[model samples]
Target: MIVRVFGFSVIVSLSALAVAFLYRGWTGLALCAILGILEVSLSFDNAVINATVLERMSRFWQQMFLTVGIVIAVFGMRLLFPLAIVWITGGLAPVEAFRLAMNPPPDGADHFADGRPSYEAILLAAHPQIAAFGGMFLLLLFLNFVLGNRGLTWLSWIERPLGQLGRLDQLAVVIALVILVVAAEYLTPDSTRATVLISGILGAVTYLLVDGLSSLFQRRQPGGPDTSSVPGPPDGDCADRTDMQHGEIRSGEPARARHRPAPIAAAVGKAGFFLFLYLEVLDASFSFDGVIGAFAITPDPILIALGLGFIGAIFVRSITIYLVRQGTLGQYRYLEHGAHWAIGALAVILLVSIRVEINEVVTGLIGVAFIGASLASSVRANRRDGRHAHHEAVRTH
Candidate 1:
């Protein structure tokens, strides 16, 4: 089971490492290994967040997400994005940017002897806008997750109050945009302030656009929601005390599943497309930090892509699939909450990092901490639930 899901990732990682050895000997191989480890450690929470989405998708779409999505993450984001950033910011041609990235200046020197800023230096300079955009997008996501009407709550003291406040429509967007504006105005330097604001605004807008389209397509799907239940027997489903009948769709669950007509069933594919699109955009927002921070490990664009993209992205995607396949989220109720908390922490870190210098490893560790605590809590909850069930059986018997 392990090998079946992760076989492709393992193959890709091994092949990439082998190529690295051939390209630059043992030193290159070691660097790639370190970067891969770093990427995985930093992104374990991303896998959790991703699982929350991948579980809702069909098996076919899940396969596409793992295969084609990795191409975008590896080649498009890790490899080409470094070049694209340099090209766009430094007014260099694509070839020049690629060359510059390939032949990076020495560490500790911000500029080449010829006075051009080094590749890492250029990335650092552009960090404000990059952080702003990603920060706002992720902030919105975190807010949406935490503020939604959820069946379970990992942190009841906090989540319950926030969920109540969620009665105010669009509160998540309002909070995210306000923070974006405030951070852009106060955290950023005067020179980059407007740029940061614009980038952050664009990020918020992008999230709204993607999320809105996804919801629209979801609603239009035949098996999707049509109208809310009017009323029902007192002992119906836990949700709304009503049955999911009369064209009602509960959550992401579709009702077709080979029962509906061919044309109506086709809406499943269209709905999956929108979900896929949302996942991709959310993924890009998550990868921004890894891609940018990867320069600190090595400025060589090829190695960065090989380590972070080839090995890390593949393994992360595989982990997402594994969680979905194993029904980890359902079994361990608090995990999704913990992952969202990690995301919220990450969002805050990114937004603050526009001015502050927070180590990427520390940022990653915070996420690990939240997830670890959540895992422990889930275990305790499961044991307690088991005890209650056992006691009830004993008494009844």
Candidate 2:
């Protein structure tokens, strides 16, 4: 399965390269390599989070994610999204915009050297705000997922009123509205206020729409059997318990020990669709910063598309595999906590980017630090548990 997936990805990637080459030779290939790496580096945490969601899905859904999801992400979000922003804000014709993107100005020349603004400059201008909104919204989503339990305690007041809505989808809309107001009042000047407001509103609304659709589908589906197909303790248990003479079998046993009959495959299918949708949203959130950031490196639309799209697709696939083979999420619970927190921080960074440029390197470093720390903590926990297991065995013998 893994080989087939990779083979398919390579084919798709090569095909894209062929098209790019047909349009513009070495320049396109160079763009592909650069953006592919950028997307991978920036979205490392995204892959981890995606893996967490994907693990719950069936094999068929996973395949769908690799194929269809890649197309939408590469074309719709990575390519069309930036183009749409240029069209709406700069008043550029779509074909002309594509032309400008395919043909950037000479090195060191201002993108707007010609009477009109360059496609690259328009693309760059779009990032700061994208970062601001996307970063913040993702942070909020991550917080709700990770610290949602805390609402039962410290944040009861906020959670209580909001909880009345009984659906996170509704809350998403409210948050999007608030962002729109902020963009209008404070983010942009009077002349471009409408553009800023519309963009902000669109960002928030897009997030809510995609995420809400995913959740609705998820709710309609039946959960599959709680398969013990995965090895180890039902999360949160120490490994030592498995070795004891207690009724429970050891951790190494086939997970089938814990398996019950699964729900109907049709139910799994529905659940799978929702899961796929959720992964797509997560990918969008993760990619937004990187996509926007790409403008900083170069304004050429083709370059941005080639770079971001190629890397984004590869990262998505790699993340899926990592999640499946390594079980990173199950193995390192704190990873999720760290990722959520990083996403929250990124949100703040995104919002700030509207007014002030936040470096991509800084953003990447911050996210890596959080996730790395969480991973270290998980390793420590695992080691501690292992020692405890050894001690118990000695005492028992």
Candidate 3:
């Protein structure tokens, strides 16, 4: 079963390595492999967060994420997105940006003589805006999870209080804005302060637009409150409740497939389309970190696409699908919560990184630590429950 789920990722990773080796020999192959590993490590939490959303999507959309989504992940974010940034910030044409990326000038090269900042320089200069955008988007996501009036919490002391306050709509937005202000004033350079603020505002707006569109597309049943409005709690255990209708086929008893809960069916039509858009935007936001981080390894666009884009993204998609199919979220009830917490930490890190250079290794380690801790908690909870169940059986006997 594990082989079936991850077979494609394995193939693609190996293929990327082979191609990299052919293109630039052992050095290229090693860099690509390292970048691939870095991407996966930095984004494991991304996979967990993605599974929470992907499981709600229909099978068709799930397939779409694996298919069309992979193209966007690789070519769009990995390849073109950097060029687009260069075009926007440097006023360089796409062809010129592509040229610069392919043949980046040495650091401190004269712009007039060379006709542009080195790709690395331009990318570094653009970090303020990138950080503002991606950080705000992720910050909103974390705030929503923390502030939502959901009862479930992995870290009860902190999350429980925050969850209670979540009933106040727009509280998250307020907090996000305050954080942005602090980032702009204290963390961002004076020259880039306005850029960071504007980008962060736009990020917040983009998040709202996508979220609103998704809500608009959701299916509404007559006489029932809009289900989407009722925010799912921070506890990862809440699977879609729609599957409960099936019950047990043979025994007329409650069906408890590995103690998994039924998930709500994803909305189709316009709703599905917007949900798809939401997923893509979420992906872009996630990719911003990887794209920026990859520059520290090598400024070669093609290699970045091969390593982080092709290999890492394929694995993330596979992991998302595996989590959904295996009902892992339902089983490891705190995993989603842990992922969100990691996201919040990453958001802070991105914002801080605009001022201070942080090693990609450290960044990756932070995510892994959060996820590992969550998995440990999940296992402990399972054992505790097992003991209780055994005791109950003993009493009944």
Candidate 4:
């Protein structure tokens, strides 16, 4: 499974290295390698979150994530998205934007020979909107997880109370908006406040629309949204343990429904489309920080896309599948919780970064810390459960 998943990453890495070397010799290759590593470090939590969503998707959609989805992620978000932003905001034609990106003027030096702003300058100027949009989107994702009513609690002290608050409708939305407003009005520069606010509002609205559509499609499913299939801690508390075990798909749906594979397949196809859309948007949100941060290393759009977009994106998708295949979420139940916690922190960091720059290394460290702690905790829990089961068996005998 490891080879099956990561073989592509290896190939992509080699290809990126070669492309970089050919483009500008060893220095370019070195930059590409660094960017690739940076992307992987930054996006590890993204892989975890993707796993949570992908686990619930159909096999066909899962395949799409590997195939067509990678293409969209690499080219669409990494390449075209930045160019489009430059085109729209800088009032440059797409071709002109691409040219500027490919051949940016040196820092404090003019290569364009024209007074036009370089790609990096324009992109950096648009940082407020990018930060606002990505931060709010991620903030909502984190709130939805904590504010959800799932019975299991890794951080029982805090999560239990938050889960209680889940009884209130639109709690996540309200909190997200409040944060957005605070960031825009108080945290951001006055000149960019309006842009930040609008972008943040749009981010929150986009989340609502996508989540609502996903829920709507889920309900339209033959069996409806199988809450059991949600990829986190089991649905019920430790006491009322009657629910399906983690990772078990409910099996009691009508066999006749199964027999009519065509309609059922059609329904699944429709459902998967929305889920796929959600995944892509989620991917975009995850990449926004990395994309913005990549400018710190090199503003060469081609290099960013080659290394971060292709190599890093492929590896993340592979890791998502690997986690699912290993049943890591079920095995280490707190992993998903930890990933969401990291996401929450990242969201805050992204927002704060609008005012003050935060190092990408710091962001990566926070996520790895959370996930690492969760893995250690999971190991201890497994040992404890094993011992308890052994004790119970001996007592019964």
**Model 2 accuracy (lDDT, Cα):** 0.61
Per-residue CA lDDT of model 1 for 231-309, tens digit only, reads 1011122233223343443443322111111111222476678778778887888888888787777777888999999
True-structure lDDT of candidate 4: 0.79
lDDT of each: 0.78, 0.61, 0.80, 0.79
**Model 3 C-alpha lDDT per residue in residues 156-201, reported as the tens digit of each score:** 8988889788778799899999999998999988998999999999
Q: Per-prediction count of colliding residue pairs? A: 0, 10, 5, 0
RMSD of each: 5.8, 6.8, 3.6, 5.5
In the predicted model 3, the residue pairs found to clash are 147-166, 217-271, 240-262, 240-263, 240-264
Clashes of 1: 0
lDDT per residue (tens digit) for residues 49-138 in model 4: 998778767788899989999999999999999999999999998998898888877654433567777788898888889989989988
Residue 192 CA displacement from its true place in model 4, Å: 1.6
Better of 1 and 2 by lDDT: 1
Model 1: residues >4 Å from true position, as ranges? 225-267
lDDT value, residue 302 of candidate 1: 86
